[model samples]
Target: MKQVPLHRLFMVLLVLLASASCREQSRVPSQAEITAISLKRGQLITCGSSDKKFGTVQFDVSCSPEAQTDFNLALSLLHSFEYDEAEKVFAGIIDENPACAMAYWGVAMANFHPLWTPPSEPELKKGVQALRIAQSIKNKSPREADYVAAIAAFYTDWEQADHYTRCGRFEKAMEALHTTYPADKEATIFYALALNAAAKPTDKQFSKQKMAGQLLAALYPNEPNHPGIIHYTIHTYDYPELAALALPAARKYAAVAPGSAHALHMPSHIFTRLGLWEEDIKSNLASVASAQCYAQEAGLKGHWDEELHGMDYLMYAYLQRGDNDRASAQLAYLQGIKKVEPQNFKVAYAFASIPARYVLENKDWQAAAQLKSRPNFPWKEFPWQQAIIHFTRLLGAVHLGNTAAATAEMQALQANHDDLLRQKDTYKASQVAVQLRASEAWIKLQAGHPQEALVLMTQAADMEDSTEKHPVTPAEVLPARELLGDMLLQLKKPQQALEAYEANLKRHPNRFNGLYGAARAAELAADGTKAAYYYQQLLRVAGAAKSVRAEINAAQNFILAHRSPQS
Candidate 1:
């Protein structure tokens, strides 16, 4: 037979190549589809993949060489809670090598974010689908199958189980996996993460947090660059009692994963816990920029929720330091964002918080009374988060002598608290309860029940002092203990107020209101020396620069009036 013409053969090969390319492209998810799926992954943002080195993770898997390389990258992202990106990478691997069972495992893992909010109905369906696909592939190794089964533990009968219960099941499965493969560093790291995820915010002893910390700290020296190790270490020790221990990890994590917006923001958790305002500011500034960059690259509308989250922290830091202008700019940026992508809990918390915090911290009762939840957002989904607005409004109403408005706002807060209880969010329910008690205390004071007000306020403060604040907040919009001090001052119990303020300062050092309140209380109690010391600290924390806050000026005036005449 005559050989085919060379040009004709080449053209035919080109056509076949084009057909294969079309098939591959069709298999890959479109940008919009990726965005929709990613919204469920908490704070999703695009990041460069040039250096996907998320520390040393050795997950042995049977797949094509190309798929294996991508698998490692995806696994690293999963450990960092970079779920959306990891899911995309894993899906791409499966597209290339359909038999890669672990890639499917990664997709399911991405949807089941143990530490963050529970998966919504859409996310659960997606996760269950991916997990079923992972289970269908029979060529998986015992280890791979075990890994798949561990996630299956979470998805299995999810409708009947609460999020915490499902997470506990997943945690137990991870513990068993760790036992089976004691030498597997991946197993150990994941097990540690599971432990931290299972920790109760109410457990003052921090048993699970410490256990996970011990595991992560053991691996830190060997895997210093590991994003999860460094990130989780900070989280494990984010409490006021344990924050100092996480300083090393907090300092290193940003450098290890400079490209990740979340990595940059995490160090601030420790800083905020320890009241390291300057460091927290730096961390969040970088995070906000990184998040914005990711949004620009993704061509998304407005800022990503990660950016808002960072900006909220940034604003909190600025306000604590009395950098009012900077804080206002952050609020302005937030107001301009007509919408937040994903609109998840992080969005809800930040949106509800930033405005409420601005007015409350400034004691701008008019603004606080007018505080409204961000429109076009799902406030119904987060009743506990929405309570921030009602709580602020109640405070504003009570301060402005609007008892009727205060009572209404207090009722709204109580309803939110009850809603949180019904949802089994005990931590948030407790938080709302504190807000309600404090609001009622103020309302009682306005209604002339001075003794009753003090009792209620003290209970609120004591309740708050019993547990740590959740990581979602930079600090309480208005710490209950500090409010107690304010209530005491209002009741003309200056000495008692001084003691209360000082107590609050010990837990939340250098807060603008804490420092200023203490100074005023000491001044009123005739403790001039203590008053002067707090005023100096206030100046230092609020920065040496001039401030827009009247409280700073009052601090300056008091110090100047009491200054020794010996020039």
Candidate 2:
């Protein structure tokens, strides 16, 4: 050792350094080590220290330098909606170190921010290029592979968005934001928006509008100043019930952002839905005033101006209050100003829908059908519109005694049944489908096709399960079961109907329909004790349901009259 020259020693040291680099490149860490390191630092790394007692240690480090840190910071900012700040930080890191693949990955994450005004084609192309570079430097990390899988699933062109989001490439903490966590409000909101943006256009495609509403409900559970959410909700009035569902959140948002036109508009819409006519009008007026003030303060006016916000609200308020004349006047005013731009199919459709709604409310089915059939019906933009149009046509056909036409409409509905099930846009669609099937089954029963009717009802029940992934609500499933029970009773299958109704009642004890159905089946079967017991249960559960209360009274009187005294 002492005899070795200085240059020779330096050469030996260089050989050792090169060898170490090569070894590190080939090293692969065990799963336990990876998990331990990830838990400790909340970051994904390429290698983990080996356990001494382990027979073999396979460690391969694949992570690009500084990738973990960049991904974590980008994820934090993305979640917080700090897009500009995150972009700036990621951009700076990429500039400093091009091979720092995580920095390029952050660029993809930053590009997904909803609030960021979308880049031009050239800009997006550049961003895609950066992501490809990051993807090329990838290692054998499972987290990285997961990220790549997600990117492949989502952005087909970039493919890295999925990878970054999935692989713990972005903040490891944000892994909780996946679609698997249905109840996580923040994740739900993000996923809904992502899907809404990504969904394809087709004849019976997924409902972007519905997904948007679900996200809005999750994000602003009791508040509503979210402009994007409010806009989508108002535009898709295909589900009026959603307005009621969103009211509490909308009111809360309005309370916080008193100056927000959307905040005021949301409550106005909700009040109208709740049939609080006076409050609806007042809220709309306030929204209109605020819009005008905002316009003046912003020094904006006329059709192209960003501040011409309240015309839609004004129109809706007038129509809701039965002041059609005023609504027409406001519509004319909106036409004249051209100050506010109609962003989507919602604006023009609103005008057409108003007339259709009037006819429906007046029970003028033929008139409603005519309006719905018009070219400007906005069927493509709103699924509910299509559903309503068909529903109206069905009603008209039924009224006119056109059996063939009514049957044809029913057939068409069944064909598009999957679309109806997938809808979360409005609870009404789901309820309507159930009722429609039940009605169709009743018609079949009347025609001496009781078995066919039962089959149809069963199909309807299955559809309910297909759409809603969560635990089936007793309220929803019970009605369908009770309807089936009635059909079975009509078919002279009282024992089967009794069993069905009893099962339904077990799940929904307080349901008047379930109790009544069971009672009817028992009575028809000549089971006096069982009939009496079911009738008594019906009365006890009727509570405040007006129809059920009346039925229960009638049944109790009949039972008393029919009772016989025995020695």
Candidate 3:
């Protein structure tokens, strides 16, 4: 492949990217209309693959023009989860206006992406420095002090507490700030987002997220072009049950500011949740292309981690459509990501998941069983990534009737789980535990221990039921209960399998494997009416993707032979 001349085409592509997506009506912010909803912070200078002004944010900050512009840029980056870029902007503000207390607040806020991951020890210290800078400046307004202090509360005793605890402190502080300035839109928006960041996956009532949604939803009409409101709102409803509510935001977010690679990719979170494969494919293609230019401009060689992240979403969308060839190509494209330093969470996830899904989605148990993590991958340095590969191997081995290998894989998974636990990484440790137990159950089932397998998998499912799936792949490598449903079907217990599948479908909703399995189970159980209903739904999403599944063809035949009123 010829190396693209990134620096030469940078400016030309920037203009094209911004125009290609976002519907920008807003402009550079002014303080006259402090509460004006039409403020456009994203008025950025785009270079091919890079944006001189990445975030199209509108700030309602009570600071000087220079400070406010910098603050707006910083907050816009934060909204897109571009913490490093946001913090840099914040640092520039501090240099430009040492007395700008809010710039410190911006710096602190930029250190953490509330919904994704916690700040590192170095990040926390950087946040602390920003706070100290704010404190030493005596000419700050009372409101500016509160803003800085709110973030300060988040970093207090950072090493002594856990990530969630710090997140809670930030939320508490934001609550106080919002209360103090009830009408301040920025305070209200930030507070709502902080609540969302601190939300737990099992909050079935989605209480905290619902609160964020209500705040964001109410503000949406007023701030139609506001990236934070639109982006955060999409996140607010990014779940299987609530995805429909987020469609408006998802449809609008990328178009509002396509310069940010993450902004280009954010909409797919909603699309993935709702099984909107076509939209996901469309959005990710543009996002990956946009990200590549920026990566190349920054001198990155093979895989741009950002581009790979978009590819992961794109691959899942293709897999849903049974486009095995596209998936094959996407995996081949991913192999080019050889350089290491920038291995982010998304990179780590795609590294394992792309291959794992390639085989697992086909129910190709033999391929999964023999899956290997390449010797070049630094397994110890990235045990979490290693854990994903092992989980797939365990699932494949047990499913393919290789009990000994499955048992070993399960043990390896447990060791990784323990390693995470030792590091106090509760969130990932929980996920590892779920995979570990699920693999063990599959191993037991392969060894003819049906009762034990069911119990073990049930327990794992119950645990996962209370939390959200990791936001890497579209969903879990098949939810454990869904796998149990598959196993039950293999045992010829269609009734039990149907029941298990229904329970899973309720939580996961329109997942391809779940929907297809439910249809097959229903047909086997002699319930042609329900079978037809599910088969039709599956066909709707499957579209025209090739590489046929025999069961899908069987479902199509059954549906055609006895079409129900609903079908």
Per-candidate TM-score against the hidden true structure: 0.89, 0.38, 0.87
Tens-place lDDT per residue, model 2, 267-330, is: 5545544444455556666756655654454344533221233454444444433354565566
Q: Which candidate do you rate higher for TM-score, 2 or 3?
A: 3
Question: For model 1, where is the 10-residue window of minimal lDDT?
Answer: 35-44
Off by over 4 Å in 3: 1-56, 60-64, 560-567
Superposed by TM-score, candidate 3 places the C-alpha of residue 147 at a distance from the truth, in angstroms, of 0.7
Question: How good is model 3 by TM-score?
Answer: 0.87
Question: RMSD (Cα, Å) of candidate 2?
Answer: 16.1
Per-residue lDDT tens digits for candidate 3, residues 1-567, read 987698858977888877754432212222332122111122233332433444356765555686776677678777777665666676566555645667767767777667765776767777776676566565566777888888887888887988888889889999999999887788888898889878887688899999998888787777777788988888888887888999988998777766677888889989888777888998898888877776665655655677777887888888877788898899887775667436667677778888888888888888888887755766776667788889888878776677788778878888898899898888789988888888878777878888898888888888888788766667786688898898789889998999999999887766778888899899899988888888888877676675476656866787778855785
Greater lDDT among 2 and 3 belongs to: 3
lDDT (CA) for every model shown? Answer: 0.83, 0.48, 0.76
lDDT: the better of candidates 1 and 2? 1
Best by lDDT: 1
Q: Could you tell me the TM-score of candidate 1?
A: 0.89
Candidate order (lDDT): 1, 3, 2
Q: Could you tell me how far off, in angstroms, the CA of residue 127 lies in candidate 1 after the best superposition?
A: 1.7
Each model's total of backbone clashes: 0, 19, 9
How close to the true structure is residue 432 of candidate 1, measured as C-alpha lDDT? 90
